[model samples]
Target: MNNNIVYKNVNLKEFTSCKTGGPAKYFIQIDNVDDLINTLDSAKKEGINIFVLGGGSNVLINDNGFEGLVIKIQNKKLKVVPTMDDYFEIAVGAGWNLNNLIMELTQQSISCLEDLYGIPGTVGGSIRGNCGVTNFEIKDVVSKVYNLDWLRFNDYNFEIKTYNQNECGFGYRESIFKRKANIIWETNLVGKKCNETIIKEKIKNIMDKRLKNQPYEFPNSGSTFKNVNLNEFDSNIWNSENLLVVDCEHRQQVPAGWLIDQCGLKGFSINGVKISEKHANFIVNFDNAKSLDTFNLISFIKQKVFEKFGVHLELEIQLIGF
Candidate 1:
């Protein structure tokens, strides 16, 4: 890799949504698969560990920063082809900003992505995390995913693999990408052609709902923890705690935010970081907080919630370098 492409000691705070973190020891941005392959090969020769970053919305970088190479995906290629009557196949680059992609698709009368409006992050990051709201998940529209095998790259072997929707191993806030060393390059999504007016209305409704419920005015990663399955807890425990259960696609779930609020942690602060009073699930960087501050507060919240409810909250945000 050349100096023109690879940068040293690049600050990561500017890239992440939380606006807190140290720096990447080595950083490079790639807009094409060829560049990614070449970069991986170069990193392998240098014996450097690799971390792929997309829009940086759902991640927390440690205060000490990452010592390895951070590859930022910036590819934004998008193509839409009509596959059948009122049905279209959309091939999108992994790095495409998800919100922007949804808007563009809505302009073309695409329907499947309307509910995802106002969600931040890139296409690949959203798929890797299986990001969703209420009853709609990105997996519902994903037809196929194309990725590079990161594990093989370390062996100086460049291999590309494609996985159909079922093979992606998608679950709540997770996918095979989270468990395996797969670098998502592109994805194929299936959408139906709908009336543009109806699509826009759906987007507006979802956006309104998010604004009313989520604390969007502050700088924060979307959701701090994944909602727990209600079945995981005894029915008597739910009644004793007065835990509210909502039906999510036939399964009952208890919102993480509710648990945090029940523990009286909403608006709680440690240094400049504080849990959002508007939504307990969001820990916002209100006054130039340090990454360590957020980390400690998350630990505190977890301890308190577990002591009170006996439910351990799992982080929805990805922790990088920690």
Candidate 2:
């Protein structure tokens, strides 16, 4: 049998969208189910820490590199199987590009992913992160999740299963995957069929709105903070009579953009990282902007916002290494 494991130091910057990260001790690509099992088993045997890297879009890695192995999910395919009564179950590999998958699904009349067009990263990343705007996360439609337990891919002994959103423990940008750190091999998305042209048009509208607001050209995580809740967050905001009625009605989910912009942080900068002059929520790398640059910018925003508004900003981007 051909050996699929790679033992080398991988420059994570090349794989990450931010264009800056240190290096990984070991990098492995799992192209199929068999490959995934093999890679995981080898890592376990060697007593190496495992980090599954999916499109590398919504994270900033430290400049010092990861101490464990980085497994890049390279298996890409979307299989459409016909179900009863004009329905279809789409099996999407975790390695698939999220945008491309959405676009293709829209073209083929898939209804669920239309509003999720502009989100970056991969199928598994989105699933694991539970990414979405407000209440429209990807886990909303997940039917059954397939997982490989203990890196055993060859046989069914190491397999595990979870069904639906409740089992997934999906919350605001969180799931069991964050704690368990297991593999999401594929997803069975059961969605209704719609007119292909209409689906495409809707996706285009939502996607265009996203592009117009966010800076797509620059390398940065989409949003820096998860909005704090009104009831569960810091208790100080409750007695304030000046809180926006809209914010109050929504309970805790305030838009990070509004809060950041309100703090006059749109053009804020530190070193080469600046809160994208276009969007307050985005912190971009201006040429020589390294991981440290973004880190400092985030720090400035957090500090300033807390001092000015008394609300701490919880980051949405996954910060690794440092």
Candidate 3:
């Protein structure tokens, strides 16, 4: 192991946005792909399980902690190349903060990512979950993604593989990275040039909407569940339930928050965790809360919503230790 980069029994609560979770038995932060390979090689030799953490915004960690090596990607390399047309490409590290990247793009008058202004977490995590709002998603701007097949570390094969946009297999709140053990190292995003004033206005409007709709005062992991596709339900069911249907990336969808609200789960609490009154989709840690408390509340919500609407709610946040 690279002793200089590795630490033992690091508290993971300090890393997560929710301010929960126990300590990581082993932890390392990698700033480059080469170092990540070397670290994975060492961990492989030790027979330790591997977990890659980015900005720690979209994860729930168990109180028992992770009994493995947690690798935090911190490579922040960035380069922008202008094309012949009114377009540009940005090559950024996986560890780059999503909000910071959007702000940088705004300063450069890039129009593609302005609508995604207020989202949290790293570029890698956003791509893994295909994070976005309304009609915009990380997949739309992604041109290419570079990652390492760490699951093959036992063979000492650490070659970097590049995937084109379609090969990413992006869907609603999902991507190939979510299914495969490959670790994203960097990505290339294509954007179009736009007026700086227009980009700023769009960002301001999106930020204002997020501040008004989301529960930001308490510690929480953004959205708890993924929205259901409208086609999954019968037309009569929608009319009978009086569910609100909205357009998402040209597809009709039902927001999970609205369903939770319909079930009367908003502002519900158990232990120190509570469903946010401001946003039914957010489960916030208003006080000191255990991971189990949040887990139980999530289970209860799924059951209630299922009983009422017969729709299964899928989690958006990654559960680590549990």
Best by TM-score: 1
Candidate 3, residues 1-322, lDDT tens digits: the string is 4432789999998888888899999999888766777788888888999999988889999999999999988888888899868899889999988889888887888766667787778998888999988888889999999988788656445588999999999988889999979789999999899888988887888888888999888889999998998877766777899888899888788999999999999999999999999999999999999888999999999999888888899999999878
Question: Which regions of candidate 3 deviate over 4 angstroms?
Answer: 1-4, 234-236
Worst 10 residues of 1 by lDDT: 151-160
Ranking by lDDT: 1, 3, 2
Each model's total of backbone clashes: 0, 2, 0
| TM-scores of all candidate predictions against the true structure | 0.96, 0.89, 0.95
Q: Sorted by TM-score, highest first, which candidate order results?
A: 1, 3, 2
Clash pairs detected, candidate 1: none
**For candidate 1, lDDT tens digit of each residue in 1-322?**
4322999999999999999999999999898777887888888888898988998999999988899999988878899999988899999999899889988998888887777888889998999999988888899999999988787665445667889999999888889889877789999999998988998888888889889988888889889999989877766687898888988766689999999999998899999999999899999999999989999999999999889888889999989877
Better of 1 and 3 by TM-score: 1
